[model samples]
Every structure is written in structure tokens, then in C-alpha cells.
Target: MLYDITHRTTYGYGSDVSVAHHLAHLHPRELPSQQISDFKLSVEPAPTVNTEHVDYYGNTTTFFTIGNPHDRLVATARSRVRITPPLLPNAARTLAWQQVRDRCASDVLTPDSEVGEFRFDSPNIARRPVLADYAAPSFPKDRPLLEAIVDFNGRIFRDFKFDSRATTVATPVDEVFKKRRGVCQDFAHLAIACLRSLGLPARYVSGYLETLPPPGKARLIGADASHAWFSVWCSGHGWIDADPTNNILPGDRHVTVAWGRDFSDVSPLRGVVVGGRGHSLGVSVDVARVAE
Candidate 1:
């Protein structure tokens, strides 16, 4: 499968900005299952300084500085990607949850060793007793890791409400637990927190999930939004992506942009501005399947 993705972000500042610096993880990642054949970033009022480099997590990042004052900033990224993923392994056949957890803390370092760092606190997710209490029901003493993960994911999807207005990027996992309401981001964070509470390695994944409209309805232009999910480390299988928002394992429909300890590490965009009273932001993402 192949896809053409376009993501556009527009910002309107109440006051003109004299200078700004920004970072973006808008470029798609290249993996055996997915390839970023080509990518480009377009900025209105081209920046005075720009540079690209890979971050600590091996994610492609672009840093740019704008010197001229402007009341608006728009960033558009276009990319072509190819994906051909193998079928997911049977969840029940995977290692037991405790075995995976034991491996993460051991001194041995497999290629999947780096995943150990994710089993702790991050800006958005922290280790809390409540999280573990909420998640314990899914993982009995001898449950398979993936099976437990899938069940936990479904629980979140069933118990929570997908309300866009319920939370913000800054919302805490604790708040989401109380309200049981949030968009994909909150669910992802909530799950990440739950896993970490159990001393398991889990990380946040930022990406786009191809969404389809009703059977007879026309696809809405730019109606789709960027999505979030979490990945857990399995001893032999490596990282497995789980989507609590949709209660499914991610595959061809998932386009990974970046992964990190939490949303703060892989935020699509973040920056410092010299001047700007306040701002309103709008974002639209479209993912279209292309013929092989």
C-alpha cells in the first residue's frame, strides 16, 4: 500500500511577532514496514534560518527561525509513503506479561534493550498507584503481553468518551481518568501511564490513522486529524503498537511520524516566540491511499 499525506497548520497571532523558532516532526519515518519515499515542508514567509537533524529518538526534526515580524504563520508538509506490513503475530502466543517485564529490568541488553528507558515517568505520563490499580484487572498473573495489552486497550475504548473538547495537550492523565473523556491523545497518555505504573516499558506514538466516512457520505476535505497511540516492548517481538482509541492493532492504516517517551518528546510542533500576545491554532490532516 502507498499513501499521500498532507498536514497543514495555521496560526494567527493577536500581535505581530518579531522573531520565532520552531521544531517539527512532520516528516514520516522509514521502516521495513513503511518508507518515506519523499517529503517536503513549506513555510509561508520562509524562515531566515533553517536546519534539519535527527533527534535522540532517531526521529527526523526540522528547526527553523523566523526573524521578520508577522501576524500569521503557516506550515504545510507533503509526503509520499509506501507501506507493506506483515500480518500481526497472534497475541496469545506471545510471551507472558511478567516475562516481558522481567527482561526490561535485567542487565542483558538485546537490540530491544533501549526500550527500557520508557518504563518511567515523562512529562505527560507518570507512575501512579491509581493507574496501576485501573490496569491490574486486565493483566492477571500469567496473561500474554499482547493479549493483556489488547484487552486493556478495549477497556479504555469502551469506558471513555471521545470528546474533542474534553481535554488539551496539557491535560494530565489523572484528569482523564476522572472524566473518562478525551480525544486520542488523552487515551494514549492514559494507557502509557497505566503500563508504566506496572513497571512496563511503553512509549507514545504520534502518527496519522486513515479514517473513513459513512458508507454513503462523501469524504470531508481536511476533516481528519493527527492521531496518537502507545507501543509496548515485547522481549522477542520488539515494540507492538496498540490503539486504545479504536481498540485495534495498528497496521497499514497507521502512518508513524515519530515516537518518544511522551507527547512532549515528539510534539508535531513546538517553539519559542519573541513576541505574540496570544494565538489561535488550526490544523488539518489528510491521508489518502494510493495505488501500488
Candidate 2:
């Protein structure tokens, strides 16, 4: 499958005279299952300095610096990618969660593959026994790791509320677990913490999910939003995607941008400016699959 993605972000400030620095992880990489055929990015007013590099996790990161500021700033990223991701059956057999976990743990998982590990004490995903215990509903010990993960995903989706106003990026995993409310980010974080607590390695995924409209209704434009999910390392299957947000596996519809141990690693944009105050940000993204 191929896709044309266009993303726009704008920021408005109460005052203009300032400096801004930004890091962008919008570029996609060619992998065994997915390939990036063509890509490009543009920034308005032009940046004084811009640089691109691949991070430790192999994600393409672009840094931009704007000085002699203005009242508002806009950043737009556009790309046309030709992807030939494996079918769900093949992906299940090859990229299964069990397979990836073993490969990653043994240091054999390639950069092109979706395998990663994070420290248990990562800031946004702090570990807490109380929360884990609370989240422990019940599961059969004899179940496969992937099956267990699926079960957990379903439980979370069924029990928690998907409330955007319930939390922020700064919200701790423990708090979200206690409140039992949050968006996809919170769910991914909570799931990561739980998996790690059990000595498993899991990573955060930033991407877009092709949303479906109600039966007999046309899909709405701009209604699709950027999404977050989690991938757990399985001993035999590789890194498998599990969307705790909806308790479903991410298949062809999941368009990945970048991945890391936590949100900090794969944030679409992050940076520090020498001088900036009262700034605002707006982001828009469109992802659609193209027929061969």
C-alpha cells in the first residue's frame, strides 16, 4: 500500500520577539515490511538553521532553529510513501510479539524491525506496584505471552474511559492508572509499565490509524487524528503492535512515524529556545492509503 501524508502545525504567541528551536521526527525509513519511496518537508518563513540526523533508535530527526522571531510559526511536513507491508498472516507469523522479544533481548533485532526497550523508571512511565496490582484483573498463567497481552488489552479497553481531558503528557502513569482514565498515550504508557514490571521489554509507537466511519457513512476528512500504541517484544514473533486504546492489533491501517522506549523518544516535535514566552501550537495530519 502507498500513502500520501500531509501534516501542518502552527504556533501563535502572545508576543513575537523570541527564539525557537524544534526537533522533528517526520521522516520514514525503509524496512523489510515497509518502504519509503518518496518524501519531503517544508517550513514557512524558512529557518535560519536546519539539520537532519538519525537518532539512536534509527528515527530520522530534523532540527530547526528560528531566531529574530515573529508572532506566529507554522511547520508543515508532506510525504508520499510506497509501502508493501506484509499481510496480517505473514506479519503474525514473522513479527509476532513473542518472536521479536527474544530477538531484541538477544541483540539480534534489526533497526528496521520494531523492537525496543526502556528503563523501568522512565519519567512519564514511572513504575508503581500499586497501579500494576490494581490493573491485575485476572489471567491464566498458562496463556502465551501474546495471548496474555491481547487479553490485557481487551480488559483495559473495556474498563477504562477514553477521555482526552482526563490527562496530559505530563501525567504520570501511576496517576492515570489510579484515575483509570486517559487517551491512547496514557494507555500505552500504562501497558508499557505493566509489561516492564513483568520483566518484558515494550516500546512506544507514534503513528496514524486509518479510522473507519459508521456503517453506510463516508469517512470524514481531518477527523482522523494522530494515534499512539504499544509494541511488546515477544520471544518468537518479533515486535507486534497492540493498540490498548481499542484492544486491537494494528494491521495495514496503522501508519507508523517513529518509535522509542517512551513518548519522549518519538515526539513529533521537541526543542528548547533561548527566548520564547506564551507560545501556542496547532497540528494537523492527513493519512490515506493509495491503491497499487
Candidate 3:
């Protein structure tokens, strides 16, 4: 499957007087199952300095600065990407969850051993006993890692309500656990915290999910939204992406952009402004399939 994605962000300031600097992670990742054909980023007001680099987590990061004063700012990213359906690892064939956990903690350094970096707490997600308790039911003694993860993913999908108004980007994972309601970001954070509590390695994935319009309805220009999911590190197989929001392993319909310990590490756009005060942010995203 091939897709064209457009993500636009606008910031209207109550008052503005000086410079602004921004960072973005809107570039789609090139993976074995995904390839970016084209990408472009345009910023209104024209940045005086613009640069791009790969982050610690291997995600593309962009930095731009606007030296002049402006009351409004707009940043837009457009891209074309191709995706092949992922070949899911056989859950039953994976090592037992406990073994994978213990081995990940061991000092032995293999090519994939670096995944241990994700086994601990990060800025936006912290391991807690309660998170382990929530995960305990899905993972039994000696259950295969991937199999248990699949069950846990499905449980989250069934238990939580997708309420966009329930939480904000800064909502605590524990609070989401208590409320049992949140958008994809909350669910992904909750799941990552749960996995980390169990000594398993997991990371947050940021991306776009192709959304189809109702049967006879015309597709809206920007109805689709940015999506979030989590990935668990499986020995030998590497990271396996799972969508607790939709309760399925990610495939061709999912277009991965960036990933890290949590959302903060891969936020699509974040920055500091020198003089802009009380800003209103507006975002619109469109993920449309293209004819192969």
C-alpha cells in the first residue's frame, strides 16, 4: 500500500514580538516494510535557520528558527510513502515472557541487546507496581512473550474507552488506568508503563493510520489524525508494533513516523518561543491511500 500524508500545524499567538525556534519529527521512517518516496516541510515566515538530524533513537529530527517577529506560525509536512504488510512473528514460537525479561536484564551484549535501554522508565512513562498488577492477568507463568502481548493488547482495546476529552498529552498513566478512558496516546503510554514494570522492553510509536470514510460518504480533507501505538522488543525478531487502540498488530495501513521511550521523545512538533504569548494550536492530518 502507498499513502500520501499531510500534517499541518498552525499557532496563533495572543501577542508576538520576537524570535521562535521549533523542532519537528514529521518525517516518515524507512523500514523493511515501509519506504518514503518523497517528503517536504514548509514553514511560514521563512525560518532563518533550518536543519535536520537523526536523534538518539534513530528518528529524523528537524530544527528551525525564525528570527523575525510574527503573530502566527504555520508548519506543514507532506509526504508519500509505500508500505508492505508486516509479517507478524508467530506468538507461540517466541520465548517465554519471563525468560525474555530476564535475558534483557542480563549483561550479555548482543546486537539486539540495546533494547534494554527501553526496559526502564522514561520521561513520560514510569514503571509502577500497579501497572504490573494490570498486566499480570494477561501474562501467565511461562507464556510466550508475543502471545502474552497479543492478549494484553486486546485487553486494553476492550477495557478502555476512546475518549479524546478524557485526558491531555500530559495526563499521567496511572490516572488513565484509573479512569479507563483516553485516546491512543494514553493507551500506548499505559501499555508501555505496564510492560516496563514487568522488565520487558517497549517503546512508543508515532504515526498515521489510514482512515476510511463511511460507506457512501465522501472523504473529508483532513479527517484523519496522528496515531500512537507501542512496540515490544522480541528477541531475534526485534521490535513488534501493536495497536492497542485498534487491537491489532500494525500492517500496511499503518505508516510509522518516529519512535522512542515515550511521546515526548518523538513529538511531531515542539518548540520554544521568545515572545509569543498565549498561543492557540490547530492541527489537521490526512492519511489517504494512493493507487498502486
Which stretches in model 2 have alpha-carbon errors above 4 Å? 83-119, 134-139
Q: How far does residue 67 in candidate 1 sit from its true spot (Å)?
A: 1.0
C-alpha RMSD (angstroms) for model 3:
0.9
The Cα local distance difference test for each model comes to 0.91, 0.74, 0.94
In candidate 3, how many Å is residue 98 off?
A: 0.9
Question: Residue 257, candidate 1: how far off, in angstroms?
Answer: 0.1
Candidates ranked by TM-score: 3, 1, 2
Q: Give the 10-residue window scoring lowest on summed lDDT in candidate 2.
A: 87-96
Candidates in order, TM-scores: namely: 0.97, 0.85, 0.98
Worst 10 residues of 3 by lDDT: 106-115
Candidate 3: residue pairs that collide: none
lDDT of 3 by residue, 104-219 (tens): 88888974566889999999999999899999999999999999999999999999999999999999998999999999999999999999999999999999999889999999
Off by over 4 Å in 1: none
Candidate 1, residues 161-222, lDDT tens digits: the string is 99999998899999999999999999999999999999899999999988899999987879
- The TM-score of predicted model 2 comes to 0.85
